[model samples]
Target: MADVRKHMIFHGRVQGVGFRYTAKYLARSMNLTGWVKNEYDGTVVMEVQGREAMIFELMKGLNRNQFIQIDWIDTEEKETETESSFEVKY
Candidate 1:
């Protein structure tokens, strides 16, 4: 499938854990591009763009981490980006 972008808000136990790092790793390894950051509300926000399957795999990878307990994820599709890297934004 073609590339797609998703803006996501991950809730519950996202901060104080290695959520950002894990997301960056997973995204990059899968050749996905975008950024992840911690929000002031103790939630994690991310925008990732890549193949649909890879995006799904990225979600599965995040959920597999023992420390990152994602109570829920709010996701929305967006216009794709040109960047070719995944990052953990500060």
Candidate 2:
């Protein structure tokens, strides 16, 4: 499958709940490359590049976190970027 990139912003009780860390870990485990960070508007933003299935799995993992409540996610498909590994960005 062709690699895909997604620019996503997750809303609702995402900050201060280890969302970024969980995403980073899940991405690494799935061999996806990208970065995740907290936004000033109480949302979490991530740019992930990998197989479409892996990306979906990453989102599923994030959604399953007990402490994280994801009301919705805004996703946009974008051009892929070169990245070596997943990262939690400030």
lDDT of 2 at 22: 96
**What TM-score quantifies how close candidate 2 is to the native fold?**
0.97
Please write out the lDDT profile of model 2 over residues 1-90, one tens digit for every residue. Answer: 899999999999999999999999999999999999998999999999999999989989988999999999999999998879999988
Which residue pairs does candidate 1 place in steric collision?
none
- TM per prediction: 0.97, 0.97
User: What's the lDDT for residue 32 in model 2?
Assistant: 99
Q: List the candidate 1 regions with Cα displacement exceeding 4 Å.
A: none
Candidate 2 residue spans exceeding 4 A from truth: none
Q: What is the C-alpha lDDT of each candidate?
A: 0.93, 0.94
| Model 1 Cα lDDT, one tens digit per residue, 1-90 | 799999999999999889999999989999999999999989999999999999999999999999889899999999997997999999
